[model samples]
Each structure stands twice: as C-alpha cells, then as structure tokens.
Target: MQETIDLAAGPQHPNQFALLRQRRFAPFFWTQFAGAANDNLFKFAFTVMVTYQLSVGWLPPKMAGLVIGALFILPFLLFSATSGQLTDKWDKTRMFRFVKNLEIGIMLLAAWGFYAANVPVLLGCTFLMGLHSTLFGPVKFAYLPQVLRSSELTGGNGMVEMGTFVAILLGNVAGGLLVAVPEIGHLQVAIACVALAVVGRVVAQFIPSAPATDPGLVVNWNPVTETWRNLRLAHGNLVVFRSLLGISWMWFFGAVFLSQFPSFAKEVLHGDEQVASLLLVVFSIGIGTGSLLCEVLSRRHVEIGLVPLGAIGMSVFAIDLYFASRGLPPADGLHLLAFVSQPAHWRVIADLALLSLFAGLYSVPMYALIQMRSQPTHRARIIAANNILNALFMIASSVIAGALLGAGASIPQIFLCVGIANAVVAGYIFLLVPEYLLRFVAWMVSHIVYRFKVRGDEHIPVEGAAILACNHVSFVDAVLLMAASPRPIVFLMDHRIFRVPVLGWLFRLAKAIPIAPRAEDPVAYEAAFAAAAKVLQDGNLLGIFPEGGITRDGTLQPFKGGIMKILETAPVPVVPMALTNLWGSYFSRVEQGGAMVRPFRRGVFNRVGLNVGAAMTVAETTPEALRARVDTLLRART
Candidate 1:
C-alpha cells in the first residue's frame, strides 16, 4: 500500500502544469503519453506500408484504413469490460507496468512482422496494440481521482486530455515521415516503435502504488457477461450512465469529421496529402487549446456548464464550415503553403479547428465528473463501459457517413446534416438530464452576466450529505451559488417562485424542492421537507434560502424554522453561504419593477461574489446562530 495523498517536495501553485513537477502525477503522465504516441506511430506506419507499398489481394488499398481501424477497435469491444474489472481488482501502478511490458513484447513481435513484410503478422500486431490500449484506458482515468482533490479534477483532466491529443499528433507526424524514408523506412519505424515501448515501460516503473479499489472482487473472465455487468453497474447511477452516453455521443459526432477529413481535403479543398495532414495538425492543436482552457475557464473545478457551451460551439462552427466550403473552385493539387495562401481556404481551416476545440471543452468536464462521482470501487468498470460505447459510436459514425457518401451526398452536405443533428441530440440529452441545462444557465449568468467570484468555497463539502444555508440577496443568488460549488447543489425554493414564468420553468427543470407556508398548504410543506430529507439521505447536497425567500431590501432576514424542521430529520453539517453586490442588480427589486425591466443595471461582468463560511455541526445549528453566520458572510467581502 502507498499513501493516497500526493505529497511534493515544495508547495505547488494552483496551475495545472505544476502537476508535472510532482512525483505522483509526472511518471504516470509520461508513461501514458509514450504509449499513446507509440500506438499512433505504429498504426500509421503500418497503414502507410499497406496502402502505398504492399499489394495483398484480400486487403486492398481502399479498404486498408477501415480494416485496420476495425481491427484496432475490436479489442475494445471484446475485452474492455474484463480489463475494467481487472483494473479495479489490482494495484493500478502494477497494471501500468503490466500493460507497458505487454506493449514492449508486442512491439518486438511487430519488429519481426515489419522486417518480414508479413501483412497478417502486422494486422495481428494492430489487434494486440488495440488490446494494450483497451487495458490502459480504465486505469488511466480511474487513477486521477484517487490522488487529486475535487478542486483539481478540471485542471488534472485538462492536462491529460491535452497531452493525449498532442501525443497522438506527434506520433502520426513521426510515422508519416519515418515510413517515407528511402531504404530503411520500415526498419526505422520498427526501431522507433520498440524504443518508445521501452521508454513507456521505464516510466511505468516510477508510478507510485495505487492500491486496488476492490481488492476482494472476484474475477469474471467472460467478456460477454462482464460487459453487461459493467454497463449495468454504470446504469446504477442515472447521472453517470447519462454522462457515459453523452461522451459516447461526442465521440460519434467527432468521428464523422475525423473520418471525412482525408476525403474533404482532397475533394473539397483540392489539396494534396500534405494538406490533409495540415488539417489534422490544426484540429489537434484546437483540441489541445480547448482542453487546456477548461481549467482557466472553470476556475480549476469540475464545471459541467462547459459541456453545453461546447456542444453549441461545435454545431455553430460546423454549420459555418458548410457555407464556407460550398462553391469552392477546383485546384491543381495544392500543397500546404499554396492552400493556406488562398484566402478561400481559411474559413474551412478555422471551422475545423474551432469544432475540434469545442469538442475538447465539451468532453473534459464529463470525464472528470464521471471520475469524481462514480463509486471508487466501480469507477474503472464504468470507464470501461464508456470505452465500449465510444467504440460503438465511432463505428456507427463511420458506417453512416460512408453510407451517406455512397448515396451521393457531398461531404459539406453531410457535415451540415451532422451539425444540425448534433443540436437535436445534445438537446435531447440535456432534457433527460436537466442538470446540464441548469448548470449551463448558471454558467452563462456567471460568465457573461457578471464577473462571478467565490471565497471560502473550500468550506463546501465534497461528499456526503450537507445542508447549504445561504442569505439569498437576489433571484440569481442560487445561480451564483451553483456556479461556485464544485458539485451540484439542489435548492429548496418557495413554491410561489416556481410560478414566475421563465424562472419557474428553470426551477422545475432543476428539480428544486418547492415549499409553501404550512398554514396555506400543509401537505405541500410536509412533502417539501420529506423530499429535502431524502436528498440528504442519498448523500447529496441540499441548499436552502434560510430566510425563506429573497430579500426585498439589502438586509439579512431572520432565518426561518423550516430549516430546523428538516434538520431534525437529517442533521447533516450546515454550510453557511452569502451573495453580495446582487441586491441592486436587475434580478432584484431595487427598481420599481422586477427582473427584465432593465438590462445589466450594473453593466455586464459586474463584480459579484459568493462567500462560503465554515460548516456548522448539528449541535450548534440554531435559527439565530445560522442567521448570524450567514450575516457575517453577507457583510464580508469575497
């Protein structure tokens, strides 16, 4: 066993790159990075060899890419469930070493296959490499949450995502260049692949021990049964399951563009092979940029609000690409320089890069959310299930795009249709899980409507049941609070607020607990308390405006007894919070009329803040005491 906490020699800043300096993260990061690079390098080299050099009748040049891709993904479909279970049942550091050792052995075999110029042997190596990746996926994802704090999830995931794409990009470029060498291209590729494998194994030895999440678990070797079991485990949590589907949908969406890039560049852009590679480089850079931005945009927390924003950007840019690519003139095999020199090609390049960038922003948060929220014991298996879905979605995307192209739809038209369809599919997913939409709205309000900030946010609980008692200054106070907390906070609101048009619809969408005065509606009041208690019992945060309603004046209202009544049922820690600089805003009653009467009363990006205070234990939680704590926060500047 090893220490669960990651300790470093010196104090580290909050920057994501600071992780590279620590023992706990650096070695594993490099190990995985080497593996990713080696996989792409080997696959691309084999692909070039098959398509341009070899002439086996059964594997034609046209079908070689598809066949190789299918062979690579097949292992994920067959072994991912078992691999996830294995990940949970063994030390993760041991798993990394085992996978790297397997890679080295596989690469040795691959060197012989390349030297002998045996197509079957090379194909077998591809499947084996795929298996290597299938095993590495779950452990790589599951290891992060075990070592990093909740506050670090966004930044940590961002770094990994960025590094993976960059590795893949570098690998592809190296393979293309190395395999094109005059006489010793094949030999050079073999040596490079073997060397990369050796490097991965060397780095794997340094990863700190991450003890088994489920050491006592029994092994289930049957992929069929275990795959089903793994998926069912994921489905056990509605949010996690839906998130799995959402991420798979992203893969599906991106696959269409990635698969079509070669065709699009040659046919639509009238560019050479080099131009296609240029497009790939641009797209990879965009993804890396979007991924690295998540930590900064989210303030180093797992903020799913970026998911919807990313989805919207993906569609917007993809559609713009359709219009940009339409009515382009044919050119005579233009290379990278000539292609970019033509101003007409710039929009197509920009669109491709932006869509891929949005894809990065869209995916990192969901991945981190799954990592943070899934049961530690079952997290790897759920991630394995996610891999299964991603592979299936990618396959579906390829088949559908191929069929559409075969049916004579132009590449731009297919892109247009997918862009339109992305909006609908994403909208449907949001409907099923309203949390994404709620967070999106809150994210917009905080990012666009005001320069939102949080202080003492560390007081917010990461796990288990807790009650958030806050001084509600304005209608948007709940939104601000949602923006600040790393995890979702379900609020208990006055029932009357739910009838206020757009605000009401939003509250209902959030699944807020709607309470009324006990005298006016006793049944509804009791039902609200019961619902609130159930939320805590289920180990979820339940938020309340301890004043019972938003304040009309910029003063602290007395805490109501409803909070005390609910506390008697489930006496969890009470976190006091406050919102400042919002009372005179448009959402408040400062003007003669209420919200929407005036826009940006204080101007966009107004200075607004949420202040969280130390949590109060049940024994010290009184109406007066809670009010005083919240009052102190309300008066204190964040």
Candidate 2:
C-alpha cells in the first residue's frame, strides 16, 4: 500500500520551472548543446567538401567512410583514459570550460581549412573535435549523478539526449545549407562553425564551477594501460558490465544506420546530397522526440522496464526498413520535393523515425542504471569504461558494415542485421541480469494492485540513514515499501518468508535481511538486529515492520521491541507509517477461526491505503511510547 499525489501542473509546472532556473545544470546543458552543434557542423561541411569540391574523379566511398570513422574513433582510443582520470581528479565544471576553449581552437582551424579548401586541415579538426568529446564524456556523465537526485536522473539524461540530437540535426542541415549559399560558399560553413564554437565558450563561461570531489587523487594519462584498467574495474560488477554492453551495442546499431546515409540516399533512394541531409534530419528529430518522451513516459524517473520495449521496437522497425526499401528504383540526384512525392519513400521515413525513437528509449535507461549503480568514487572510471566500449562497438560496427557491404549486402539489409543483432544482445543481457526484469514486474504489480497515493512523503529525509516502521499487513509489505520509498531499502523480513519458493528467490536476489521471531529462532533474531543496525550505521535506509507479523484480526497489533532495540543501537530517525484496508488481501492470513475476513481469499483488485507520519528522533522513541503513537495514528485513519 502507498499514497499518490497529483502533480499534474503540466509541462510548465512550478517545480520543473524552478529546476530549469538553477545555475548549476542550466549552463552545463547549453554548453553540451553548443558542443554537439559544432561537432556535426564541421563533419557535415567536410563531407560535402570532400565529395563536391575535392573530388576530380570518382571518390573512393569506402575509403572516405573509413577515414571519417577513424576521426570519431581515434579520440576515444587515445584520450578517454586520461580524460576519465582528469574528471575524477579535478573540478568537472572548470575542466568542461577548458574543453570548450579547446573546441574554440579546433573550430578556428576548421574555419581556415574550409576557406582554403584544405581537406587535410578539416580532417585534422575533426580528430581534434573528437578528442574534445572524449575528454568531455566522463565528466558529462559523472557530473550529473553528483548533482541530481536519483529520481531526477532519467529526465535529466533524456533532456541531454534530446538537446544533443536536435543540435546535431540542425547543425548538419545548417552546415550543408551554409556551404551551398552562392554568396558565401564553403567559407560560410567554416564561419558558422567558428560562431557556434564561440557561442559554446560563452555558455561554458556561465557554467557554475564545480570543485573536485576527489582532489587528492593521482592522475594517470597512459591511454592503453589506464583504459584497460578502467574497463577491468567496471566489469567487476556483473550487472553494471552487462548494462554497459547493452548501451555499447545500441551505439553500434545507431552508427551503422548513420554511416551509410550518403550511399543509401544516392544509390537506393535516387536522391541528391540534400536527401542525405534530410535523412540526418529525420533520424536526429526522431531521436530527440524519443529522448524527450522518456521523461514523460517514465513519469520523471528512471525506469529500466522500457529498455526491453525499446529493444523490441528497434528490431521490428529495422526489419521493416529492410522490406520498406525493397524494389525501389535507384536514386541519382532528385531534389527534396521530388523525393517526398514518392509514395514508397514514406516507408523509409517511417522506419527511420521508429528506429530512432526506439534507440532513444533504449539508451537513456542504461545511462541511468550506470549512474545509480556505479560506486561513486569510481564513477568516472566506470564511465570511462563505457566510452571505451562505445568506441570499440562503433569501430566494430564499421568493420561489420564494411564486410557485409563488401559481401554485396544492401544498406537496408545492414540496418536489418544491426537491428536484429540489438534484439539478441539486449535479450541476453537482460536474461543474465534479471533484476532489471524483476523490478519491472514488481513495479507493475504494485501499480495495478492498488491506487497508491503518497502524502507528506517530503518528510522522508532525502539523505543519510533512517529507520522506517510500519504494520505488517501482507506478504508483499517489503515490495510495497520498496516501491514507495525513493531510496533502496535494507528490509528485515521473516526467515520463513525468505525460504518460500519463488518469492524466496526474489528476496534473496534483492539481498533482503532475514530474521525469525525470538520465540521461533533466537539466533536469526540476533543476526537480524545486528544486520539492521549495521545497515543504518553505513548510511542506508532500513525498513522494519513493528507489528512483527501480519494482523490476524484486522486490528493493530502491539509494536515489537525489536524495532526499539535496533533504533536505540543505531540512533537513526524513525518514520512511522499506517497501512489501511489491506486486512482482506490474499497475503493476510485472516479468518482461520474467529478473525475478520479471510484475507488470503480476497482475490485481486482490493483497494488499500498507507498513511505516512512525520519522522521521530531516536530520543523520542520507546517500545511502549512508540506503540501507543502508532496505535493512535492507525486509529485516526481507520
């Protein structure tokens, strides 16, 4: 049982409005926006220049593609190891400003290259830009978990992704359009790149400086040794490692689709350079829409349940893209308007949109998982591992693409291959780490079982340790507590329940602490008390049912002395709660003889209530006194 509040103040809700107004996150957001804009700005300009301006004969498409891929790959390989170390050792905001300054220099070089029509210099700038991103990557990820609440992670990441992809799409379009302008030509593209870089720097200046959390840390700059070392640490956690792989695989799937656009547009769609541009637009827009939708769909919290759904969509839509482009007349420079008029092209458009939407849904949750799960001190190192895997997976994608394309596979077929591969990879990872799946099941069950409404939830302190005491009303009291509590809980449950069939497996998986009543098993009782105290001392939430067992008569039971013992030992704040109308549920063993309703026989769809009281300090609690207090709280609600 839980309580709910209607926070339906719409998109411009006061809380969201206050969040956006914050100095710390707002400027950081725009700095990323500018960085993404400039990255695609230069890439789009360089691609056009190489094909139209530099090529006197037929351009070696595969070779050009490989060079472009290398530019993106080199930074992650060469700099991210050092970058992660720097992020951990220094102030992230200050480091971000320095990275932005480096971007300014890179853009100036790109601007000159465009003006001189110097392809080599432009390529050099691309490599430099990638290096900047490499350095920024760890800091970008590690900074958010430090600044935002656990509940805010999903929405924050979604907003970042949305801003990034939207910027990429606009930059790609703007880059091409600027270069093509008759009065400015290629030089205008460079000019715009420099301007965006400057804008990025301006925003970076406004970003609130963050002091280093680990200032006494040693810095290691060796890419090969350190990168491998980082990956080793990240892989130590089986679930975290698998989540990283799932994320990397998504990038591989995305990169394959993005890299083949020019050829796909020219050969398959029979469209011009602008058509390739439009493909970029559609993909970016789809990703942006999907990214923003994550916050709304998840109700502003991280929900890994959506990951499976996204994987399913990615495979299905990608396969559709294969069939969508089949039997099309080859393209050879038809303009944008003409391309749109073609009825068959609409399938390609729809496939791209769905593919991107699913991709957005897929990637956001994995990021949140890493943030929530990774050890804080080693967070940057773990994120560094993510960057390394992303690079490797992306590089692998290029190799796979090259091999398949060389084997005479079509671009659409490659899309299908990557998409199907994503499904297989995602499924395997989730199967190995069933927590993601189990959480989804638990979340769904609680949501459907009753209309949970939380009130005065703000009284549940945000940080440090505390003890939560409520009546034992049902078998799933712990599960309901987990859903209602914002933080992860170290729950004390009966040893008997801990051995019960399928649910026993769940409790064990959750790492729940088991105890037997003193009368039943003295040793287990002692162990439970010790475990509960240790958890509170270590700064984790501890939930205990003061009632000790489920109510047999649908009336409040005497408060157990166990809670008082643990509280006195740990000296943490106590939060009292009352559960109403759950006595007839299947979990409650009611009416064995002369009790109220047969609680276990009350099927599904039973309405229940949970009312949370304000916190009580350790000094205010006594076994007798707290029992009276809880009795009064429950009586009022009843």
Candidate 3:
C-alpha cells in the first residue's frame, strides 16, 4: 500500500503561485478560462451584430439587447437549482466533462447561427449557453475546496478569478473585432467560438476525478420547489447566507459598472470601439492584479478583512470615477492613442483601475470563506443558491439602472448612486455581522500596528481539535495569533476584558470564551470551561493564555490549573506558543506609570515574535509542563 502523505503537513507556507504548477489546479484553471472566454465571445459577437449588422425581425437594437440579456439570465433562474442538485449527486469530474461537451455542442449551434445571421437561432444558442454556465457554476466553485488544501483555497480562487477576467477581456476584444470584419465577420466569429470550445473540452479531459459530495442525493427536478428548497438550505447558515449576499452584491455592483462601459465610452469620452477596449483592458488587468494579490496580503489565509477593504475602495474609486468623467470634452472619433494623449483621461482610467483592483480584493476571500464554511455535502447547492442570488441581483441592477436612466440620470450619475448605495449596503451587512469589521481591524493591526514574525508555525495542526496554550503578553496577542495561524482560534479570554469598550465588542465578535476566576464567579468559570471543551470537541482550535492574563512584568507568570482542567475534560493535544518583545507596546502596561498608552511608544513597525512549540500529547501535558515548554520557546527566541 502506498503511504498517502498529507500536503498540509508537508509545507507550512505554500505560495499561491505554486498551485498553477500542480496538476490538480492548472488544468481546471485553463478549462474555466476557455469556457469564460467562449461565453463572452459568443455573447459579445451577437450583441455587436445586433447593433451594427442585419436588422432582425422588427426588434429595435436596444430592445434586442434587452431580449438577449433576458435570454441569457433566464436559464440561471430556471436551471440552477437542478444543476446544483446534479453536481452534489454526481462525480464532479465526470459532470465537468459532460458540461464541456455540452459547451461544444452549444458553440456549434452558435457557429451556425453566426454563419446564417439567424436571430432566433442565435438567441436560442444564448439561452443554451447560459444553461451550460448555470450547470458549470456550482461544480466550478465547490470543486476547489475538495482538491486544494485549506491554505491553498484563497490562492486557487485568486487564480480562477484572475484567469476569468483575463479571458473575458480577450473574448470581448476578439468578438467585437472579429464580428466587425467586412464579409466573413460572422464566419470568423463562428470559427473562433467552435475552436475555443474544442480547446476547452481538451483541457477538461485532463482534470482528475473529484468524488461526489453526496452520491445518494436524490436529484430534484422542479425548478420552483427546488429553488425554494435550495434557498432554505442556504438560509439555515447565517454566515454562509450573508456571504452569499456579499457575493451577490458584488455582482450587482460589477454589472452596473461593466454595463455602462460602452455607453460611458461613447457619450462621455466621445470615443469609439478602441477606447472602449482600452477601458476593458485596464479594468480586467486591475482585477487580475488585485485577485493575485489577495493571497499575498492574506498570507495564504482566507482573511475576511479584505472584503470590507474592497468594499470601501470600490465605493471610493467609483465615486472618484464619476467626478473624473464629469465635464469631459467631446472628441467625436477619439481613438485609444488620442484619448491617452490627453492628460484628463488618465484620471478616469485610474479610477476604473483602482475600482477594479478593490473589487478583486473584495470578492476572492468571500468565495474562499463560503467554501471553507459551508457543509461539504450541500456545498454545491449553497453555491447554486449563490448563483441564483447573483443572477437576481444583476437583474435588479439592470432594472434600477434603467429606472434611473429613464428618470434623466446620466451614466456617471448612476455610477455615483451605485457607489453610495454600495456603502449603505456594505454598512448594513457589517452591522449584521461585526465579525467582518473585527477581522479587518485585526488584519490591519497585524499588518500596520505591529510587524509580526512567527516561527515553528508548522507545529500548529492545520485541522482537527487542538489546544493552544500561550503566554499572553499584550491586549492584541489574540489578534497577532489569529493573523499568524492558518485556522481560526477560539480564544479563552478574561471576562473583564470582554467588558472593555471597543475591544470588548471585537472580542465578542470573535466568539471568544469569557472565563472568570473560580473564586470570584464559580458559575462563569464552569461555563467558560464547558464552552472551551465544546469548542475542542467540535474539532476546532482553542487558545488559552496559560498564565490566565496579560503579563505585566514581561515575564512568564506561573501557570494556572484552568488549562489542566480544560485538558482533563477535552484531552486534546496541546501546542505551546510564546510571544516576545510585546511588553512595552502601546497596548501593553509597560509604558510610563504602568498605564496603557498609544501612538507609537515603540515607534513605527515595532518587531514582535510568536514562536510555536511542538504539540504535546494530552497524557504528558500539565500546567507546569506546558508553561515550561512555552518559557523555553520564549527564551530561545529572546
């Protein structure tokens, strides 16, 4: 029998770019890229044809655009529930091949539609293409978590997003240019679509098998009833459901921005196709760059902090974009070069780029969080519900945009309104779950307030139940640990700390267990121990300050028996860690008069270190032993 080595155990820190070199990730990435490119290619080609070429069957160009939009979105509304069920019930690899083959068939039909200039056939192909995407959506997302380790999820999703936007850019440019050719324009589009479809299928054949999440899941056929059931399943998990909302809101925001590109280019910039293409390229590149950066900024963890950061940037840049485009001059036939020749246009481009970069930062982590949090069995269905919500949000954006435009709002004004609305919606969601805000604060503090260096991080297990016994040096020790560790830790904190003003809310949001001294409050202490035990029993990491409070003298305090009591109940392995050089920091009491002070007492970017010792078996662990191990780690670092 071949021994299966755990990838998580093999490397403590794996770079995001490494996934691109692995078989499990590379092929699927290309397949998705090809598929996205083909979808946009056909859709863009048809839209261009409608706008410029043959007048079809009494429908105005604007009405035709709307009709095509409806056709594309109709399948998501009707077929996503069934598709989600299918993904859960069947092997994802096999289903992936089936979907790719379906795409080939759909593209063949699209080819003929393009060749014949047949409006009805093209519209039918659009609907079928949407159905193909609808079927692929759930599998595409849910498949990542199964194949990649927990740490790699963020990077994998980042690559996927980066590949997707790059593909979209290529497809739009190729489609628009190809369909504009004099005689063979339609044929050219047809051939490109068929060729890309074939390439996508070839890539799909190389994807390894992903076992069925729920092989016995009975496929639900009714769209309405199943859709309701799927929504209910999603609603059952508040965090997952809220993540779905965040993801959907991003789509709504994106659709509004993207849908305005052509019109905004023509009316505001007085530019032609080349200028529109330029805008598309800049936005796509920005998103791709930001997506790739998410893994770097997160340090290979799914940092939810980026979501709020992204949301804030999106609104800020979008508002700036509105202002930048205001009062622009008319340059009737301005091409890309001429537009770039002018200095004022640079601001518009900068706004779009920054807006897109933040959008990427906002989205990649949320997808990772959803995949990480959702139940494995019903993950696909939850993703399906997410897709449904995304479609609905996109549709709602269109409706709202139309209403605004009909009411005499220019495209830039609409952009401004969406930006303001984004702030309101994001604020509301953050209020509903302060975890997002708390995470942002932790991330910022670790990255901005203190420069944290970690050693022996490999000693910490990537999954399953474990107890982390550490000596807390400052108030922000938990935050530092959270930023360093790959998995979330349930910290056992003093109840008094939980009563402090702003920090209290943050600790509560992190779901920290609040313990009291046994002599002071026997009931609270017992409850805190019970909660700690439950956290470990659920196979999560529980962190406790074995000294029971922040160190006031920059030295390890004698260990308390609470650690032993919790270990006696849960009996999980204990990993001892130590924090060094945090004693005189702003949050520490080592400042003048032993009072906590802020604003760079240690100057900017003060060095702090966390050394994680090896895990100790429960049979050998005790208060004295664990404290000794942590002191040894601290001494070695010092």
Candidate 4:
C-alpha cells in the first residue's frame, strides 16, 4: 500500500542542483545516465561499422540501418505493456538492480560480437538492449515522482532530461570517434560498453528502495491484450491521453531530424563524421540547456504553457533550417572546422540548435504533467503505454521519411513538410485542449504585460484539495492567480464573466465554476457551490473571490457567505491569497463610470504582487477570519 504523504509539505530541494546532492536522486541519475550513454555508444558504433567497414553480401548499408532501427524499436512494441505490469507488481529498486545486471550481460555479448565481427550477434545484442530499456523505461520515470516532492517534479525531470541528452552527446561522439580508429575500433567500443555497464550497475546498487506502486497488480503476459488495456487506461483521462500524444509527436518530430542528420551532413553538406558529431553536439547541448531552463522559467511548476511555445519555435526554426540549407555548396569530405568556416553553415547549425531547444521545452513539462496527473496506482503502466506510442511514432517517422525521400524529395523538403505538419498538429491539439493555450496566454500576460512577484507560494498544497480565497481586484485576477500557482486551479467566477467573448472561452476551457447571484438565479448559485465541493472532493485546488465579484473600489469589499458554504460542504483547508497593486490596472474597473477601461492603461510591464498565506483549518476558516488573513497579506509588500 502507498503511504499517505503530506501534499502541503513543499519540496526539499529548491533547484535541480540540490537534488543532485541528495542520495535518493543522485544514484538513480548516474545509473540512467550510464545506461543512456552505453546504449547510444553501442548503437552508433554498430551504425558506423555497417555504413563503412562491413561488406555484407546480403545486407546493403541502407538495409542494415533499417534493420538496426527496427531491431531496437521492436522490443518496445512487443514488451512495453508487460514491462509496465511488472514494474507495478514488483519492487522498483530491486527491478532496477536486475535491469542493470542484465545490461552488463548484454554488454558482454556485445563485446564478443565486436571481437568476432559477427553481424547477426551484433544485431541480436541491439534487440536485447532494447528489451532492457523497455523493462527499465516505466521504472525510470515512475520512480522520480515517488521519491521527489510534488514541487520538485519539474526540476527533477529537468535534471533527468538534461543528463540523458548530455549522455547521448558523449556516447555519439565517443562511439563515432572510436569506430573510425582503424583496426581496434571494435575492441575500444566493446571495452567502453562493458565499463559503462559495470559502473551503471554499481550506481543502481546505491539507488534507494522505492516500493511498488501497485503490489497487488496481477502481471499480464499477453502483450497484445495488455497493450490495449494500458492504452485504454491512458485514454480514459483526456488530459493524460492528450499529453501522451503530445509526447509521442515530439519523438516523431525529433526522430525525423536526428535520424536524417548523418545523411543530411554527408549528402547535403558533403561533410564527414566529425561534421555529423558537431551537429549532434549542438543539438544535444541546446536540448540540455532548454531542459534545465524549464525549471527556472516555470518557477518549479509543471507549466504546460511552454509546450505551445516550444511547438511554435520548432515549426519556425525547422522551416528556417530548410531555407538556410537550401542552396549550400556541397564540398565533399568537409570536416567540422571547414563546415563551420562558412557563414551559411552557421545558420544551419543555429536552426538545428534552436529546434532542439524547443524540443526540450516541448517534452519535459509533458513528462512532468503525465506524472503529476495520472492515478498513482497505474502511473507506471500509463508510462509504458506512452513508451509504446513513442516507439510507434518514431517508427512511423522513419517510414514516412523514407517514402518522402524515395519519391525524390530533398532533405530540406522533408524538413519543410515536417515543420508544416507540426504546426497543423499543434493547432488541432490546442483546439482540443484550450487550457494549454489559455495557460500560455496567462503566462505571457503575467510575464510580459504585468510584472508579477509572488511570495509564500509554498502555503498552497502541491497535491491535495484546498480552497483558495482571494480578494478580487481585477478582471484578470483568476488568470494572475493561475499564472502564480504551481498547480492547476479551478476558479469560481461570476456567471456574467463567463459570457464575455474570448475571456469567457478561456474561463470555460479552464473549467471555472460559474456562479450567479442567489437573487438572480438560485439554481445556478447552488450548482456553483456543488461544483466547488466536487472539485475539493476530487483532490483539486479551487479558487474563489470571496468578495463575490471584482471590487468596484480600490479597497477590499465585505466577505461573502459563499466561501463559508463551500468550506462547510468540503471541509478542506482554506488558503488565503492576496492580489495587490491592480486597482488602477487596465483589467481593473478603477476609474469611475469605467471610462478609463482600456488595454495597457498602465502601459506594459505593470507591477503586481501575489501574497499567499498559510492554509487555515476548516474550523478557523470562517469568511470573516479568511478575509482578515487575506487583508493582512494584501497589506504586506510581496
């Protein structure tokens, strides 16, 4: 059984670096880092061998690359569901130990394959490695949320993402360089793989134990049925399922770009292995930097707003990459330095780097969201379903790229096509879930239009249900609160506000509860309270402007009874929040007769403050008391 944890207890680590200093996170970090590096190291070495040194009478270079890709991806399709079930049924830390040990054995087989120059054995090892990864994938992600506090999820995921890409960069460079070292290339790769495997195992041994999320879950061995079951579970939740699609699409986008790099470098730029490695380095570094930046940009929240921003950047930069590389002079055997010497090539590299940076922005939050939203009992299985989809998407990308290229389309054309497709897909997704776009707008308004400073935000619970009572000072009060919050909040607003044009659409998209005055519509007023109660029962944050509506004056209005009624029904902790310095803002009804109502009346970058007070118990949460607490917080400068 899962132990009850206090969701109100904030994160132990303020940043990713603090997480690295803790044993609970560090060991698992290094273990996964080693595993990612080893996987790429072996895979890159094998690809180079097939493309350059191997002379298989049966398999051409292209066929070999295709076979290798298929071999690695096959395990995900075949075993992800089963792996998910196993992770849920068994102890995760013990499973990690076993998986790491399995890696060592796989590396040993790889060594023999390299030593004997056996094509079949090398391919078999690739398949085995894929299986190893499939088994570990669910555990790797699920383990983090279990160990880290809710507030740390974003930062922890950022560290993992950054580490994975850095590992990939190192692996690709080392593997490519080693494979080109004449006769002893295979031996060098074999040694490195084995050494990395052993180090990974040692690190795994130090990983703190994390109990299984669902110890009573029965293992389902049938991959076909289990895969369907897991997918259905994911689909049951619209947000989680859409997040899965978003993550899979990112993989599809990345696969198309990364898989084509070597060929693009050779055929388009007419560059050698070093140039390919340089491309990998630039892209990988961008991803790492962006991943780390998510923590800072989000202020430790799992901000999905970054997803749309990432999608837009990816499309724009990808299209630019096509244009930048469209008419480059092809110089055969051009090295990294030579490629960089040209000014146009720098544009190409810049595009690649920017695309990758957006990819990091695109992916990390989705991962954190999935972890945060999914039912804990089945989180691992949900992740497995995600892996399955990711593999399928990547495989589909290769097939699509091959078909497009086979039809005489240039690499730049493929890039352009993919970029256009990304924009279309992103539009469809944003339409389906307007909250993503809404949040993006809220984030932008908070950061760009109004400079927001928050204090005592930790007073809001990270996970459990809580009621937030705040003074309503402006029309955008809820948007500002949502922007400041680390978790998604359901706001209770006046029904009239829900009828406003674009803002109403966003309010509805955010699932805000619309309340009417009791004198106007008793039924809707009662329904609103019921909705607020349900939100609390469902373990979500619900925000209410206890003043009933935006203040007509610049000062606090009398507290309404609706908050007491909602609290009486839900009996959850009430967190008092204050929004300050917005009485004269554009969104505020500050001037008499509303004559001064206009956008940017205070100009761009108006200063605003949000002060969150400690949560009060239901017994101490009368409207009068809560109002006093909020007033106190409002009076203090944030």
Global lDDT scores for all candidate models? 0.90, 0.78, 0.89, 0.89
TM-score of 1: 0.98
Reference-based lDDT, residue 265, model 4: 90
Best by TM-score: 1
Candidate 4 lands at a TM-score of 0.95
Best candidate, lDDT-wise? Answer: 1
Q: State every prediction's TM-score relative to the real structure.
A: 0.98, 0.84, 0.95, 0.95
Per-prediction tally of clashes: 0, 7, 0, 0
Query: Would you give me the overall lDDT of model 4?
Result: 0.89
Model 1 agreement with the true structure over 258-336: per-residue lDDT tens digits:
7888888899999999999998899889998999999999988898999999999999998999999998878878999
Q: Global lDDT for candidate 2?
A: 0.78
Candidate 3: count of backbone clashes, pairs at least 3 residues apart or interchain: 0
lDDT of 3 at 589: 75
| Candidate 3 lDDT, 1-638, residue by residue in tens | 21222445444436777777776777789999999999999999999999789786676787877788889998999999999999999888888899999999999988999998988899899999999999999999999998887778888899999999999999988998999999999999999999999999998887878888899998879999999999999999887899899999999999998888889999998898888888889999999999999998987788888889999999999999899999888779798899999999999999999999999999999999999989999999999999999999999999999999999999999999999999999999987866678778878988888887888887888779999888888888888888777667899999888876778888888899999888999999899999999999999999889888877778889998887888788988999999888888888877244535566667988888899989999888988888889989999885
> What lDDT, from 0 to 1, does candidate 3 have?
0.89
